[model samples]
Target: MAGTSQARDGRMALSFILEKNGAPLTGTSGSLAIGEMGFIISKASSTSAFGDIPVGCFFIASASTTLKDGDSIQKVKPYFLGFATSKSLSQSKNVVDVTMDYDAATNNVSDGVVSSSGSISGSAITETLNMESGINILQSRFTSIISIDGSTIEYKEAQTTEKDILMLGWNFRDCKVGEFLDIDIVPALFSNLSKDASYGSSQTFNVDYTGNFSDENNFVGGHYIVKNVEGLLPSIARPQAAS
Candidate 1:
């Protein structure tokens, strides 16, 4: 594998590990971006989801467009993919490691946002992304007797800070049916992962778990109400969906 290939694939492959229908769908969030040009949907580069991004760097991932009502989704690689928001979108200078599966002909747009124009030069304002329904459990006990299925954990001696529970291959142990795991280790917020991303055409997009949960409002022993139910994007999944 090429040097850049591994890095790009590694970064993006994880981006698409969404729990689809309660199953981890190993896909990629190509990239979505909107700018002076127009709305664009991301095209996956490789099955490899590796991308060199900041710790909290994230862009939106969508199989389809949200803000643009009629914008038809372009299937670049069938996987959601995109670059980080580290810099502005430029056709010549800044485009890097971006993979393409769809072309101008294959790419389609429908029921888009609206026919409008902007007078401000270089002043691009991104639109807001919408999320499905979800809730947060505050106080709960996550006890897991993971069989490990008789497997070995990799990281045991690594330095794990107190803020983060340092257990290799057992993070899932802390999670249960009804508990919402915050991506960020701040304890009661979204994940450190990117909830929203910008891609192909400067179009705004988000990471959402469209998959359904195992049961509705089904409270388990480990899950407690962390905060009120708020409509956020997908990382906030009902893991019960996977069970």
Candidate 2:
């Protein structure tokens, strides 16, 4: 077993697709601009009570167009995240132990052993990437910012708001094609930024961001290890009109 075991590469590639409202943004692969706001689509079975059902192929909105609810697009590709310097995933469990008084001498027990109950309480993924360009810095401030058009960007400085929700995809360098990790952040936010510009040094911007998962509509956003079917695109189900 040990000789046959395979090791995975440490290097990973990060990518994401923007979703407007409830639909995904479609565009050429690896062409997403900074400050683009979008949502990740999460679907569950009508019969299942909880959790998201992973789909082989997901949709995206066109970079040249904005999408509204119930809108559909023909293109399907995800944008690559900037060069990542470091990345980590963190998860926590909320546990409670049930205890009761018990006879120590009769039971020969010095500690009470009853039962424990717990559930996933918190999860987050943090990553630091080297910004590819100056404009990429806008990603750090995109939580409350909106792009009215491809050329115009706005900051919601006057309103109380939350960060933009997005989906994160991580592909291992040595993994088989179409096998990767998928995570949906209720909102992905930039935590901090740093830049160094000095003689004989190329300007590199440190873009540190975090993606958080939370329970919403009986669906607790979490990570999914996706293994897409080889040589085939996911089938899309179209809504049928009344007969």
User: Can you give the TM-score per candidate against the true fold?
Assistant: 0.16, 0.42
Candidate 1: segments with Cα more than 4 A from true spot: 1-57, 62-155, 161-236, 241-243
**Candidate 2 clash figure, as a count:** 9
Q: What lDDT would each prediction earn against the true structure?
A: 0.20, 0.33
Best prediction by lDDT: 2
How do the residues 1-243 of candidate 2 rate in per-residue lDDT, one tens digit apiece?
111134434343333323233334332222223222233333233321112333222332212233333332323233333334444444444444444476333333334332211111111222323322212333435433343545555444322223323344434333343443344333344555455567775555454445444222222244445443332211111112100
Enumerate clash totals for all models, in the order shown.
57, 9
Q: Which ten residues in a row have the lowest lDDT in candidate 1?
A: 133-142
lDDT digits (tens) for residues 1-243 of candidate 1: 222222232221111111112211223323233210111222124322222211122222322323222122222111111222221111112223333575444443344322211110111222111212111010001111221223542222222111111001111222333333222111111112222235754533221111111112111011112211232223312232311
lDDT of 1 at 42: 27
Report the lDDT of model 1 for residue 160: 18
